[model samples]
Target: MAKALMIQGTSSGAGKSLLVTALCRIAKNLGFKVAPFKAQNMSLQSFITKNGGEIGLAQALQAMSAGLEPEIHMNPILLKADGNKGSQVIIHGKVYKTLKPKEYYAEKKKLWNKVLESLEYLKKHYELLIVEGAGSPAEINLRDSDIVNMAVAEYLKAPVILVGDIDKGGVFASLYGTIKLVGKSEKLIKGFIINKFRGDVEILKPGIREIEKLCQKPCLGVLPYFEELSLSSEDSLGLSYHKTFSSEKNKLIKIVVLRLKYISNFSDFDPLKYEPDVELLYSLRKEELLSADVVIIPGSKRTVEDLLWLKSLKIDKILKYLAEKGVEIIGLCGGFQMLGKILKDPEKVESDLKEIKGLGLLDIETTFYPKKITTQAEGYCNLKENLKIWGYEIHMGESEGDLNLFTIKRFATKEIKKEGSQKESIWGTYLHGIFENDDFRRFILNKVREKKGLTPLEKSYSYKKLREITFNTLAKLVETHLNMEKIWSLIKL
Candidate 1:
């Protein structure tokens, strides 16, 4: 067994992802081949790996911290909520089908084996594997077959450093109660860490002393509340964005994103947001999307349903406006489904609907197929002049675009792999996380600037450089908050 440590949280949103990233950054700095693993994670936000499997975005960020390309083993199980009552569950980087509340829990027990398979694979490959637990291990009802927390730890025989959110109050109870309720036989959970504390360090001394005295575990130390870490939210919750710098002087281009009910992979907007002189905003209401310079439809879990939402929101008018104005309107994955002529769901993968009218921006039709096309692709943008770029493609429905209006060339190893149809000003592709590529990202930014009649900035932030900035900020957080020596002591190798 590789020397392992499990960082479990007292509850959801208790700084678990952040803590795991710290451990990852710190471990790498110590010259250890470290990796981040979360057996299972339930969140509205999800990511598609290179192989076309979805994992938690937090694990993806953690993988970035560890200098490893994102993969499915880092997060074996990803639960994307189709709605409050149901979720699209991806197990072992494969879709096991959608399940409602009762059905999900019924089959939940069987997924532990897949989780173990991934952990076993990681244990063999890495010098240190920092595992992160979902929600809380202390939730007694979920403790029996819980694979994300104690169950995962027990299987690997990894030690745990449970984290408590002091900023949320009840830190003492949360810390003490978690240890009191969790299975004592897991042989995990050797210590505890108090996080997000504010005010003086001296004030937390008594509480830390009391927690250690009661739980009989060492207190790793309290992390003071620091909020300057410019990181992406794994799930689009508890996030507030402000237009710190105005875009009026820079660019007149406006990107209107259709904020659908079950939007899955909205992180595609991160690159757009990172671009200078570009205003990336989402319209929750129908009227907000009208008169957009570039109307973008993001990926959705329920394409047909979100299309209905798009109509109700009157996004069709915005698409028409962009199309008539020669605006660059693009759709990705499920969004690509909506840009087509029609969407057919005969298999009822999403709904019982057979066919529905689409925006018809791109000359195309999509059919929901049984087998999903999940893979990485290298290509150049099929603009008036091709630009070299590479991006991943993750989508279930197959899109056939019209030859006259929309065109894209898929390349692999300096050769043409496949060709995409082009139609008019509308572009559609079955790629989810494409804009993350620097050249493609720059193309979008520069094009948007030209459309808006503004000159693009000379200083462009490359995605690789942006990741360095984000990762380095996270490293700083680790240096200030976590006890580096204590965490290093926990790594077995």
Candidate 2:
């Protein structure tokens, strides 16, 4: 059996994911075989494993840090919100059911067994397992059906560390209240982490000592805010990080994404943010769109509902004006469907509306189907000399169009398909992570640069290499601030 420790938070967005990732890398550096496990994850930002199975992005990054292949056992259950009262539930990397809050709770017992089975399987292989808890362990209304936080900690007899965000204010109360609300489960918590501390550590010492005295647990350490760290987040809560960027460089290309209400896969543009000649922004204001050299419409969890939102806000007219001004426009997944002439939902898979008019930029029509296509793909993009590209597809609707921009081979299959559509300055595709390829990303940017009469960048950026450097940077940062000796002692029997 593997020794285990869990990082639970006072609330969501308390830096639990980042802390787990750093520990995984630090443990791997000490010559221990490590793995990351989360009993359940609720996020639209997901990754496809080598076997074409889906898992959370944070777990995938942790797996990379541990020098191990990402697998289905790492994240046994995933819940994708459908922009309604329900969520699409995935068990063991496959779609099990879609249920509302009441219906999901009705099946809690059966799902608990499934979670235990996955933990037992992962324990047989790794020497140490770093577990992450979702939301909060003290959610009073959800404690009875909880299978992710204290439930998993009790099952493994793991030591717990409660983390609270000081940036959100009232850290002392939040930490003390969380410990109090967990009742008998409070004994498992060995210490507490105060994350995102900004000012001098001396000012916080008095409060920290008081908290430790009240809760009967030590304050492990206070982690400073890293303003320069750029990594893929697990969900849209990280969207606040993508505000304004005022670059003084000459001829900087500004790319703005139309931040949808139910945006999914926003991490698709993380690569673009790192480019030397690019400045990425997400906006819902009309003034922001007028300054953009290129406008991107990212994937949405509910295409029909979001499309209606665009119509309601009159952003549809703004898109047409931009397209006519010779600005480049790119639509991905649900956004691609919005570029078509019509969207038909005969089965009402997404909403109550049977059909809706599209942006009418491309001569394509999409129909919503019950079965979704989820697979990894590699292809040759239709640029000058055909740049090789690779990405994955996760969507419910397929399009019928006359123009094709890429020919791709689906994973674990011999079949080929002419996918994606392009017309003049507008391009639409169902592939996410299409810009991860260095040659392909640079080629697309060069096209825009040539049109704007700006000089093209001589060197291309490698996203894969940048990710490795980022993981190491984070590992070093945590090692400097955290109490590693105590952490190691707690995890050991």
What does candidate 2's lDDT look like per residue over 1-493, in tens digits?
A: 8999999999998999989888899999999899999999999998777667778878888899888888888999999998565999888777788999899999999889889988999999999999999999999999999999999999999999999999999999999999999989999999999999998999999999999999999988889988534577777765754543436555678889988999998888988888877878888789979878889999999998899999999989999998999888999999999999999999998788889999998889999988777778898987556679888888887899755889898884646998899998899898898987788888888888888898887646698888888888888988888898888899763
* Backbone clash pairs in model 1 (N, Cα, C under 3 Å; residues 3+ apart or in different chains), count: 10
Candidate 1: deviation at residue 86, Å?
Answer: 3.1
Give all TM-scores, in the order shown: 0.89, 0.95
Location of the lowest summed lDDT over 10 successive residues in candidate 1: 405-414
**Any residue pairs clashing in model 2, and if so which?**
none
| Candidate 1 per-residue lDDT over residues 1-493, each given as its tens digit | 5778888999988888988887788778779889999988887566656656767888988898898888899998888777754877888777787788678777766788788788888889888888998888888986665778887787777888988998888999988888888867434678888888788889778878877888789887777786633456666553335232454544545677777777766777777776656666777554545556677778887888889987886768767876887877878778888887888878876677988999877777888887656555665665646665556565666766463322333321233444344466677666556777766667666766766676666646676677767777777776776676776677534
Error of 1 at 448 (Å): 2.6
Q: Give the top-scoring candidate (TM-score).
A: 2
lDDT of 1 at 1: 50
Q: What TM-score would candidate 2 get against the native?
A: 0.95
Q: How much lDDT does candidate 1 score?
A: 0.74
Once fitted onto the true fold, the runs of candidate 2 whose alpha carbons sit more than 4 angstroms away are 238-246, 412-414
